[model samples]
Target: MHLVYHNLRRRLLKYTWFLKFLAFLLLVSTAIFLVFKIVPLLLKFPVQLVNFLKPPQSVLRTTSGRTNFILLGMGGAGHEAPDLTDTIIFASLNPQTQDIVLISIPRDLWIPSLRAKINTTYYYGEQKQLGGGLILTKASIEEVLGQPVHYGLAINFTGFTRAIDLVGGIDITIPQTFDDFKYPIPGQEAAIPEANRYEHVHFDAGPQHLDGATALKYVRSRNAEGDQGTDFARQARQQQVLTAFKDKLFSTQTLLNPNRLLDLKQTFSAALIHDLSDAEILALVKTAFFNPPNLRSGILDTATSSGLLTHPPVSARYDYQWTLIPQDDHQLKDYVRQLLFGQ
Candidate 1:
């Protein structure tokens, strides 16, 4: 009886070990299915998942249930003010609701802490330490917007153009016919003849396909005639191009093609600057994948009816330079808060 009892105990222990092994295999298989099969299918045919699927809250860093990122676009080498962050957009995503809000901060906005234009913060930060540009930029934006910034990404012209080209270009619709005769040719800013420095670019009001260079011009054209010449209009155009590029990037062709995705990764890796870890980056991609179609975008310009900000008159206080300042600090914060929280 004693021998039989000992033999039965040993068999029970063996059964327990087998059960553990099976559980381990099941966990791994589930992870693989989610990553390899489900994710790719969702990318190929993205549905309105926000209605049914809410992202796990612990996936990324967030403040007040909103994850915020600052996107900085620089002119890059060979262009004047290569380090200046001409395009500053504060993008906030609500994983619970999959709502995205894009707020364009003008480069000419003043930063009292740096005693300079907001655009110069990144440049000075880089001078102080490596990878400090994004840090400083994020801090400055947080101060102005009254929100915590979780991450920052800085992309130059090269990366912008190359990424678009890698995906075989993007499709954009010109909302209105416009002409930009002063589109400065790269590396020719100081050329002898001013006439030779800029080449004329025109687009009709209709659907159009744009290559890398032309798309760059479409977003960077700040000297177009009439309403299109305004910085506000340029900001709108930039957002439109960004939406188009994002759609192209996640389209079935791009998502399913391994070679194209690899090439894009290589190109972006060379030209992009960010402080995101591998896991954090994946989390953001997942957030975007499950996001809804609702996108709210606005530019904080003094000309807007909202009047959240005002153009302070040129004075020695601003070094005799034009800059935008909030009309009411409290109101500005409230405006941003409403955009993010709808409260």
Candidate 2:
């Protein structure tokens, strides 16, 4: 009877020990499942991060250390040939040195064998329903200039007007009197009669207050007299418009006024197509204001801008095209490098 009692006690103790061990194992398993599985699902926060919480870097910057961008302007939805990018500007920013540079390519710039203007590459891509004008144009510009654009903003014609209006209009100084008999009338040409739609527009020299439509015409009209009519003049007008725009955008009133900010945000959000997220844009704006850099501007076709870009000889196939092609890739690369990097 003593031996039986001893064995029974031993069995009971062993069973109790097993039960405790099992309970502890179960607790650990529950913890592992909670941490490795359930917790991640509950958090659900990987996609929304911009560069995974670090500030966004410039798109132009390369892994090797160069940063630059291409800015394309097109006619937006509801405009004829909505994808035709009329403006192509390359920008470079050296973060280490805080130097900023911009160079403009005329819409008449052409690439060989594509039967497409460099400006229209995006449009052609969109027409094919491939849906990546940004990619197409970026590639073409790189091919043409021997420089690549990592970051880009493709603003439409309507966006340009709306952005100006949102900023309460931009003030510009017209350097010369000019006129365009062929300034395009916006809206549906198919719906409206041709005679009623097309009208002669005039811009007088001197300080002028311009609303959106007038502002757009002021910079874009290439048929005006003096420098305004020439490609170089139009580019000058474009630079002027950009200066005015930057001033207004960074004005104390615009920056301080909540209503103005909201309006501007709404207008730009609707009008522009860009790779930038809200956070990235904010970071860029902060950089622009907090660390304003020296801005240098250039146009590719100007006589002083390396002189490699040239109009085609009077050939029916090329002359009627009205475009400029680089004499050699080497010169093109050198020219762009000088403009972008101050090299």
Candidate 3:
């Protein structure tokens, strides 16, 4: 009877081991399936879209091992007009530290002989000038900041709105109540009639939800608050939108959702123009998401006194000036270097 009991115990132990082995195999198979089948299919959307839009360019090999880019917004003429760049922002990322910095350049900031607004750089390039808009803009910015602009991505205003919507609109806080005169919609030659243009898109200064169109209005609206109706106000709004965007993009659900990824790729595919290779972009994306760095922002303070260039030709209501980087510009450059290089 004792011998019989021992044999039965050995049989039970063997059965338990077999069950454990099977369970381990199931878990391994699931993980492999996700990495090989699921992730590849989902990531392909952005990869293909990016390829279609910019294609890849040969980039200079770098030992600094840091990735940097410029995010440009062009407010070209007409709905289909392609002229100068309306906005230029330098964005830098440090893979090791995951820090980011965005610096905005005023389109009208005075550059020698180039009374032409910054956005006009693209127009100048398109005119078959010696250098294209991107080249001219990069030269101007590099002269001002004393650094190399490794790569740049340009987005149209419409594309910006579409991308925002694709990502599921962003949330922002209104600082005050204000009015936004209706501006002509792209492709519509007739000015939005003055009467129809004066829509009161007002919101109390506080936390609120904003859709893509409304958020565009919020950032582009200069007269929303009586006290805030200048380029400075616009810059602040731009920064706010950017921060909100980063937050949304980094959200786990947004990053992980295959549908959202595809939508994002499709929405911005036509609008985005970049000069980075697929490998570089993938590396940068991985670094940004896996190891994020602190983000910092600041504006250039010019010598021109307030209200000096209150009324410029194109948009009389807008302000302009011959802005100069402060004498202590090195401080700003150092901050940027630290953010980008993680040194």
TM-score of each: 0.74, 0.69, 0.61
Q: Compare candidates 1 and 2 on TM-score and give the better one.
A: 1
Q: List the residue pairs that clash in candidate 1.
A: none
Give the Cα-based TM-score of candidate 2 against the true structure: 0.69
lDDT of each: 0.69, 0.59, 0.52
Using lDDT as the measure, the top candidate is 1
> Tens-digit lDDT track for model 3 on 1-343?
0000011112222221112211222222233334444457447777544432331222323326544555566654355455566556655544555555555555655444465555566677658664365666666666545567777666666666765676678888877666655443455444455454345666667898777787777776756446656766765676677668657766776768777766665555565666665455544444433444465544433333432222225432223443332334455455445545555
Kindly list the per-residue Cα lDDT of model 1 for residues 1-343, writing each as its tens digit: 0000011112222211112211222222233334554566556654523311435456578889988888777878878889998678777878777776766677888887777888998999999999899999889988887889998877677876787787789898889999989988888888888898998989899899988888888877879998999866876777677768767876888768877766765666666688876455555556544543355555443445555557778999889998877767766676677667778
Q: Sort by TM-score, best first.
A: 1, 2, 3
**Per-prediction RMSD in angstroms?**
18.0, 24.5, 19.5
Off by over 4 Å in 1: 1-56, 170-179, 202-209, 225-253, 290-294
Candidate 3 lDDT for residue 106: 56
lDDT of 2 by residue, 162-261 (tens): 7667678889888888888767766646644566655688988899989888887877675665556776676567767766876786678666776666
- The count of residue-pair clashes in candidate 2 stands at 4
**Best candidate, TM-score-wise?**
1
